[model samples]
Target: MNNSKNESVGCIVNECKFHSMGENYCTLNKIQVTKHETTAKDVQCTDCGSFVKR
Candidate 1:
């Protein structure tokens, strides 16, 4: 599916691998949006890469 014009979401990290360009994070840094398969839309965070989950 195509993301809506206003369907934008951001994260709190700047160096995240999932961080895409043109997206705005609520915080000052870049954040990655985690996708949840069973939920309504993207929701679950796969891995922080540099966190305990990694």
Candidate 2:
């Protein structure tokens, strides 16, 4: 597992396995980002495809 710190990659998903404890950051070296909508409209249309429920 690529358990590296990415200071710039902030995550608020506390239920995610990759979410750092007591912090707003992700421990994963990389994360898959995907579009939820058919057409690219706004930030809301995007989601973290790599989220794994803990």
Candidate 3:
């Protein structure tokens, strides 16, 4: 896992493979973000494409 202090990848999904245990953060070096809809109406329309099931 990356311990870089400069990175601020915060996450709450404990089921994700890249989610840091007990840290509420993502350990992936980078994440791919994508829109779930052609026209996003709210934050719920966004999705983290880098998510992998643990």
Question: In TM-score terms, which candidate is top?
Answer: 2
lDDT of 2 by residue, 1-54 (tens): 556656878998989988887788888888899997899699999999989998
| Shift of residue 14 alpha carbon in model 2, Å | 0.5
TM-scores of all predicted structures: 0.24, 0.83, 0.80
The TM-score between candidate 1 and the true structure equals 0.24
Off by over 4 Å in 3: 1-7
**Local lDDT at 1 for model 2:** 54
Residue-level lDDT tens digits of model 1 in 1-54: 122222344444445433343463322133333544545443253533332111
Query: Could you tell me the C-alpha RMSD of candidate 2 in Å?
Result: 1.4
Question: lDDT score of model 1?
Answer: 0.36
Q: What clash pairs does model 2 have?
A: none
Instruction: Answer with 2 or 3, whichever has the higher lDDT.
Output: 2
Ranking by TM-score: 2, 3, 1
Clashes of each: 3, 0, 0
How much is the lDDT of residue 11 in candidate 2? 95
